[model samples]
Target: MTAKVAGIPMILCALGVFVGGTIWTIVYSFTNSKLLPKTQWVGFEQYERLWGENRWLTSIENLAIYGACSLILSFVIGFVLAALMDQKIRFENTFRTVMLYPFALSFIVTGLVWQWILNPEFGVQSIVRALGWTGFTFDPLYNADIVIYGILIAGLWQGTGFIMVLMLAGLRGIDQEIWKASRVDGIPMWKTYLFIVIPMMRPVFITTLVIIASGIVRVFDLVVAQTSGGPGIASEVPAKYVYDKMFLSQNLGQGFAASTMMLITVAIVIIPWAYLEFGGKKRG
Candidate 1:
């Protein structure tokens, strides 16, 4: 009883902070606030402005493309890497370390490096031109329609490493007897993995998907560092839009409204996913 009483203060303190911050944001979202709070309430005006903004809409579209591509690419690449590593391949430790090392670096640094590499004049395109492929061009980073794919490529480079590690850990926990039995039954290796191992790894995959989705929702640094939503705001995302309005534009009300919209959007998407995942687990 003494220990429980001691813990109560800490729990209460955390709850207080969380509730306070949420209320502050909610209040700000409904006001005509600026750099500093003025407490002038203008309910739904900010939200209406945000909904009517073209840039905000563009940001949402870009985020959809970015999130979908990144998630799919990361999962496919990570699963393949995990499967190959599980085969007792040579220098497995070295391969694993090499695959995961990119995640250790900052997204700012990663984006800068990729920006340099994707530059058409002096990067991969130049190198390819030097190799007698004069007509070759690798300028996806500059193309409005394809710039998001460039960001996705860089993001996947880091994110796939995390998924690889998770999948590898899941693979390692599988019983060796299953593999032996599959071998004894002369089951093709691909069929064994597809029909047997992949199903067993579903929980790990779902968890990884959740983590990736959350990362996508909060993605700002990489977009800012890489493209700065440039090439005509083709790569704008919600987090970047919120930051620009809050800090750069000093439109606090609009910023808060955008943030609130983002929070709602995330909740809408994640609530169903969370229910399906956790609810299924409970039933199981």
Candidate 2:
């Protein structure tokens, strides 16, 4: 009772900030507000423009590509690293620290680091050319065709380590008795992991998926620092579009509409899964 009493302020703040702020954003999203808040209502006019914009379309396509690739690669790379670390290899602590160091940096820093690394003149391309290969070309940020992948590279480098840590924790939580039983049953190590351990780590994997999915949906900082939605808006994501519209372009209505769409998209993806995750557990 005392704990609940002490939580009153926090509860009020959540209601005032998150719920209230969300309602305000959604309300204004339907208005013809620009630069400053106006009483004029737009009635989905901003949404029409949002859907018709080529740049917004590009952003969605790029987001889809980034999200899919990031999910697959993050899981695979993180699990592989975790599995290797689980072997109790030599210099385990040192290797883990080295791998996780990137995750400590902010997305902005990661983007800038990758920006320099992907620079055609002074980065990987230049180094390879300097090594007697005069015709080397590998600059994803400069090429509109694969700029999103460039940002994805930075995203993966910065994020995969954290995923590895989470997976490692999950792996460490497995019962040693399971390993003993598998060994007695003459089960192959790979088969045991694939069929037994992974299945048992379902909760951890679901949590990791949620984290990765949310990050993919709201990806903005890396794109800003690395490519700034270029070369030619090739790396734009939904969050960036919302920010540009609201702050840069002073199109508050449009920005609000975009943000609302993002919210809906997230809810669409999350609500059903969450119902199954928590609701089914409660029922059982």
Q: Backbone clashes in each candidate structure, one number apiece? A: 0, 0
Model 2, residue 264: what's the lDDT? Answer: 88
Writing each residue's lDDT as its tens digit, candidate 1 over 1-284 gives: 99999999999988889777767887899999889777999989999999899999999999899888888888899999998898899999999999999999999998998899999889999999999999998898899989888998889987798899999999998999999999999999999889999999888987888789888988887888889998889999999999999999999999989888878777776887788788988999
Q: Per-residue lDDT of 15-43 in model 2, one digit per residue for the tens? A: 99999999999999999988987868979
Query: Which pairs of residues clash in candidate 1, taking residues 3 or more apart in a chain or in different chains?
Result: none
lDDT of each: 0.89, 0.93
Model 2 stretches with alpha carbons more than 4 Å out: none
Model 1, stretches more than 4 Å misplaced? 1-13, 273-278, 281-284
Best model number under lDDT: 2
Rate residue 178 of model 2 by lDDT.
95
Query: How high is the lDDT of residue 84 in model 2?
Result: 93
